[model samples]
Target: ARRVVATLSIGKRSHFATARVAMEAYAKRVGAEFVVVDSTAHASLARWNATLHSGSNSHFMKLPMLQWFLEHYDQLLFLDDDVLVSPFAPDLFSSVPCEAFGAVYEGYHKQGWHSMHARSFCSLYGLA
Candidate 1:
């Protein structure tokens, strides 16, 4: 939870109210205050494509989380749901350089696991 603690925002206090009991319990344990938000992945590839395209210019897929960041932080780490951050996670970002960062990508199709073009995205790595 150390990774999540420093990023959770308090701007949307009302929205996070419903989860207060559980959230507070979590906060007490991990020392975080997670604000709630809705996340709805689009149904079609076309929509997802458009969202990514538009996101590059304006508010991206981060949406509500982006809003929370705008209201409370300058830079926030964005972690994909599937990743498992190790105990050493917090130190991962403490030394990263500026502008560029590391990510997990489907290196050329030469390295394959079957069906199609390799899909790549960042997970567990620190984001600035």
Candidate 2:
């Protein structure tokens, strides 16, 4: 069984602080190890790898933090602060495919790919 840890980054914003509190409660309820990355304090550490093109996008910092978690954990669940974990949410670590990265599709488009949003555009233009 792969040991899993949950992680989230919190900026200096107030909303993010509230989100962190919620995430911490969720982590406690699920009996999972929770890691909080302080974007305001350790922003420089995340820039060690120039290839990632981290820029001002604090979300990119998760890359280095994820790597660090990988060293100590078998798998990592990187959740955004904005996400609200439901009590009914399934155990994700057990469902993740072996040797493959897993992510949920936001399902913004029900028809063709043409209706996809900015993320699709970034993928197409190689900017993401």
Using all chains and alpha carbons, the TM-scores for the candidates as numbered come to: 0.31, 0.57
Clashing pairs in 2: none
Candidate 2: lDDT over CA atoms? Answer: 0.58
Off by over 4 Å in 1: 1-60, 67-71, 97-128
Which candidate comes out best when scored by TM-score? 2
For model 2, residues 1-128, the per-residue Cα lDDT tens digits are: 34544555544544455445546666665556777666534533444445446454454656666776676667667787555554456777767854668997765656655324434534543545
The lDDT of each candidate is 0.36, 0.58
Residue 46 of model 2, lDDT score:
49
Candidate 1 has an lDDT of 0.36
Compute the lDDT of residue 114 as modeled in candidate 2.
38
Query: What's model 1's TM-score?
Result: 0.31
Give the per-residue lDDT digits (tens) of candidate 1, residues 75-105.
Answer: 3344332233342333333334323354556
